[model samples]
Target: MIAAVRVRGRTGVKKGIQDTMSMLKLTRINHLVLLHEDPTYKGMLVKAKDYITWGEIDEETITQIITKRGKLSGNVNVTEEYIKENTDFSSIEELAKAVVAGEATVEDAGIKPVFRLHPPRKGYEATKQSFKEGGSLGNRGNINELVAKMI
Candidate 1:
């Protein structure tokens, strides 16, 4: 799955970019959303590249995010019991695998689509620049380390 995190706030942002971020479910800074790597999402990512960072995420990182930050409806934390009771998966790891393989989604496992993440421990690089320029925006090839810091 592709992981996208909103790094910047809405101040002075264009209506079009704000709408794109909203559609991606990245409505606030440090919020995360996992999406399939499809053309539609790619286009949205490109359009909102100045305000968010995205990259391919591995199963391990996904598992960590779910265990540490995943939440269900009514503000409950996601547990193995919840997964077993609500979805076909018996555990969070299985659910993560299914999600990565595109067989399921976090919502399918009863977790909320949006993950509220803490800011990276040491903070972002340069919010105004792209990842290629050592900033925190745009596509970042592997975001495991960044997600690790946030979690």
Candidate 2:
């Protein structure tokens, strides 16, 4: 007689943290930072080992996330204002440009990964009707021509 027991547990479930990272469907986890205008803005950069949301680096979001997670190490202003404080970023495009140049962190620094959306492969030409219907002397012609090149 053979008897066996299977054991499984919630070993992989991460607790109490979520962000835009999940939207990325990331193949790899890399660093993300929020930049600032003044050299002083770098002070608010929050480091996350996992995914994070689309929060402005100017204030609050970083503070709350970093404070709650305790995964990042650095000083935070502890203020509860982001959108209001970051009013300068009028549009998502403006926000993105700043992030690219490293002038802001979505607040102080604009550091984010470059996302290039690539189109998927068109897939194989699954049907062979074109080859088959090359008119009249088709099927044998394909085999004979291939062999003729050898001769």
Candidate 3:
């Protein structure tokens, strides 16, 4: 799965990018969403690259995110028992490992897919330029560090 966070605010955003961001379920800055890596989602990401940062998420980081921010229907915090009761996996670690291995999905386990994150502790490098230009926007390759800061 790919992890993406909205890095920029809504002011002055183009309507197309705003629509794409909305489709990605990122309606606010610092909001995060996990997406399956596919051409369709990739196209959307490309369209909103200037307002978000995305990258492949590692298993360890996925586990951390699930353990720390995974939620369920009715806004319940995800717990080991909850996972065990609702899915084949007995624990969050198992679920996360399975997701990373492409054997399971959050939907299959009935967990909420969106994660609302805090702004990164130190803020972003730059939001107006692409990552290639030393900004935090665009594909980050590995977003564990950035996700950690927000978490």
Candidate 4:
């Protein structure tokens, strides 16, 4: 059920990239699960930073977003037991592969589950106008204005 989630928040662990975390609760996924042939992975509650404390899902999602092979993937496992057991695997891909190879259980993927994330359904980005501000900055006043103008 590999579905891309629209990330939310901008204050989590940072790597070379993953600049910002998702900040809104806006997610529109029209599709359900894709091919459920694979085992379903769950999520573990990590800390949250930027907003309140620290520890968020941004890092995991960003890592998984990479499509190129060899690139580390996001952690899809979310079992407390697994996390309690192993505290290694610097990358999500390593954890994922571990799960595939039966070395680790789905719960032991290290990364949180995927369902909690916003799915990638390609929805229009919200603008200031939507928030009662101006449009975009391209003559519309703000980015939204420019978008509406272009449309």
Better of 2 and 4 by TM-score: 4
Per-residue lDDT tens digits of candidate 4, residues 11-127? 344532232212212122211111112322111111111111111122233234321111113533334344346656644555555543446533344333323322223433442
Better of 3 and 4 by TM-score: 3
Q: In the order shown, what is each candidate's alpha-carbon RMSD?
A: 0.6, 23.2, 1.1, 15.4
Cα lDDT tens digits for candidate 1, 24-127? 99999999999998999999999999999999999999999999999988999988888888789888999999999999999877789999999899889999
- Regions of candidate 3 where Cα sits further than 4 Å from its true position: none
Candidate 2: regions farther than 4 A off: 1-85, 107-151
Backbone collisions counted per model:
0, 18, 0, 24
Q: Deviation in angstroms for 151 in model 4?
A: 26
The TM-score of candidate 1 is: 0.98
lDDT of each: 0.93, 0.27, 0.90, 0.27
Give candidate 3's whole-model lDDT. 0.90
TM-score ranking of the models: 1, 3, 4, 2
- Candidate 2, residue 97: Cα displacement in angstroms equals 0.2
Q: For candidate 3, what is the TM-score?
A: 0.94
**Model 3 C-alpha RMSD to native:** 1.1
